[model samples]
Target: MLNPLSLVSPPALRAALRDRLTFRAKLTAAFTALFFCAGAALLIFVTVLARQGTMEQFARITMDHTGGPTAPQPTSSTSLAPVSPPGPDRAASTPGPGPAASTEPWQKAEDARLARVEVNNRLQETAVRQMVVWSAVGLAVMAVLSGAMGWWLAGRALRPVRKVILAARRMSEENLHERLQLTGPQDELRELGDTYDTMLDRLERSFTSQRRFVANASHELRTPLAAQRTSIEVGLADPLPAHLIPVREDLLITNREAEHLIAALLLLARSDRGLDETEDTDLAELTRQAADELSSLAAERTVVTTVHTTPLSVNGDPVLLKHLASNLVRNAIQYNHPQGTVTVRIDDARRLTVTNTGPRIDPTRVDSLFEPFRRLDRDRTAVHGHGLGLSIVRSIATAHGGTVTAAPVPAGGLRIEVRLPTTR
Candidate 1:
């Protein structure tokens, strides 16, 4: 035989399994089932006790009574007392029939006694049957009522849990200071809420320390890099020997790339730290500005650029939002083949999509493109970028409470889509 579990689809089975894990449902089902089973047991015990009692009463009495024209009629009493035959003097006066003739009334009396006993047994059985049926019906109704009551009680008992879940959802890494300061009786639920708040307290402190460290490190790192860049520009401004000229240019290029990397790191850190404040900013205008700035780069690569946009406003940091657009367009241009096309589109829903014709990316490996410092060539010295472009785009979008997704195009290249809410 096929396993019954196999008949259920995987999704349906998962749903059922998850439902069974619900605390409220489990509590209600357990209480109802226990009550129903116990009630049935009690009912069965009473029924059997009543039946046994009736049988015992029949066993105790003789039931050897005679029936005749002058005999007393039967009654509804449980015990039937045997009657003694008429005395010898009374029999002599009555001139009763012979012994064999007397057998008729005795036989009839025995038959009548057996018949009455059978009828009483049937009546008792019927009474017991009716009692069982009605009791069962009452038990079923009570079970339903108990289930409903249990469900409500369970919900009330679990109210604190819902509060914790809501508070956890509201308190992201950026807002770890929020706490579930639940109020009510000092029960398990209250204790749980208090524990959660304590955990958040520790988390908030840790995040504050980390943010401070990042800020200090960023300042320290940028200072030297800026000085280095200035020195290179001033010291190497004059022409040099034929061989020294190439060396000077290489030094300048290396210094500039280093500064770019440091700046990218700071931007990524700021985006991950989350927006401090938000304002209404037109995404269409930002996209135009960012893409326009990269127009020269696209021309240098001989890649055609196309932009389609509509007025779209969203609430976020303007600097970060512009960078998000700039990075996307820059990556499209930088990674494309000569004569390839880059298309940027925006809509009123605060959505932006940038499609580019480039070398085909493996569908499976496309997800890794969003990781910090991941390059398709697997080299940190790749010409186009330091591999932080997509990662920074993802961080900025996340800080704005938006989503970004990329999929490889069928013909070649990638189509990246971003979705942002219209308002904060």
Candidate 2:
């Protein structure tokens, strides 16, 4: 014999399986099941109650009387006493056959039995019909209501997910700054949105940094190229020997500037790549070397340079770290005034400080000191330093798991500090 359940058509079976997996379908199915079960239970209870009532009524009828019916009681004083059989034999004067045996009593008993059976059958039929019709109607109504409610509830629960999807679709690199910012009581969806927003925040910062770096690089390169082109064009225009020597000198100066700019750009790129090699090196030693390297430049500019060292070791790329130290010292010496002091200090706490007596800087411009190609008023107008000095310092320090901070000195110039984790 075939299993009745397995006899379902293929299309119907597939649809049922598909519906079972979906949230909406599952929710609706759950509601329908509950409604159906409840309705069936109520119907069964009602049917049982009705059946019990009918049985009780039949039982009452069956047990109510003594046998079928009691013998008829005397109706009045006239029939209170028996007839006395009408004087045994009233002779020939009495009716001939004494009224053939009466059959009325037997007929009445038969009629009563048939009437009871008919009433019972009619009552049962009525109850069964009513139950079938009303239960079906109630079930149909409840199924519809349950399905609608389930659909509505499911939509409400998924509303936040829809918002997240829409927001994600509208996202791009240019609009990474946009946040879901979903507001509600803490739940899984809210947590997800908050996490997504945090990720976007990180992406936006990274993009902004990259864009600024590229723009600064382009502007720095273009300025030198433009100057070089102008110098060459002017030099070629004046062919005289006297003018030619001066023009050649101008070309050399422009070429040197371009060279310095290119070197700075390359150093900046390397620093941005982060440390690819690590070694235990004394920061104090690097600081001393950097100071010695810039000592001549300092002297030529009438700036006195000094280095104070205490052995403090850190793990980082030696080249990048050396570059970091050199940039700081160079900036100090290049930006200092005549008779000014440049102090490079390496403390035992893994901190490097470079202080210089240069033109007093505006406090507001201190933060911008570490931005690529950004310089103070004097450095901006001066023909010398390209402004990647502090930026390179900051990048290298960060790559080595360190922090750099700078403050404008009250007595003129800048005080910069770099703190690195000590090698263990």
lDDT for each residue of candidate 2 in 290-368, tens digit (9 for 90 to 100): 7888888988999998888898888878888888999999988888888999888887666899999977789998999
| Candidate 1 lDDT, 1-424, residue by residue in tens | 9999999999999899877788888889898999999999999999999999977665444253433224444455514645558899755765447666757765777677777778778878898899999999999999999999999998888899988988888877767877778899999999999999999999888887776776678778888988987887788777666877788888888888877887888898899899999999998899999988999998998999999999888899999999999999999888888899999998655579999997777889888899988876532234547789999999899888889999988888889999988888
- For each candidate in the order shown, give its overall lDDT on alpha carbons: 0.85, 0.79
Tell me the lDDT of candidate 1: 0.85
RMSD of model 1 against the true structure: 6.5
Against the true structure, what is each candidate's TM-score?
A: 0.83, 0.49
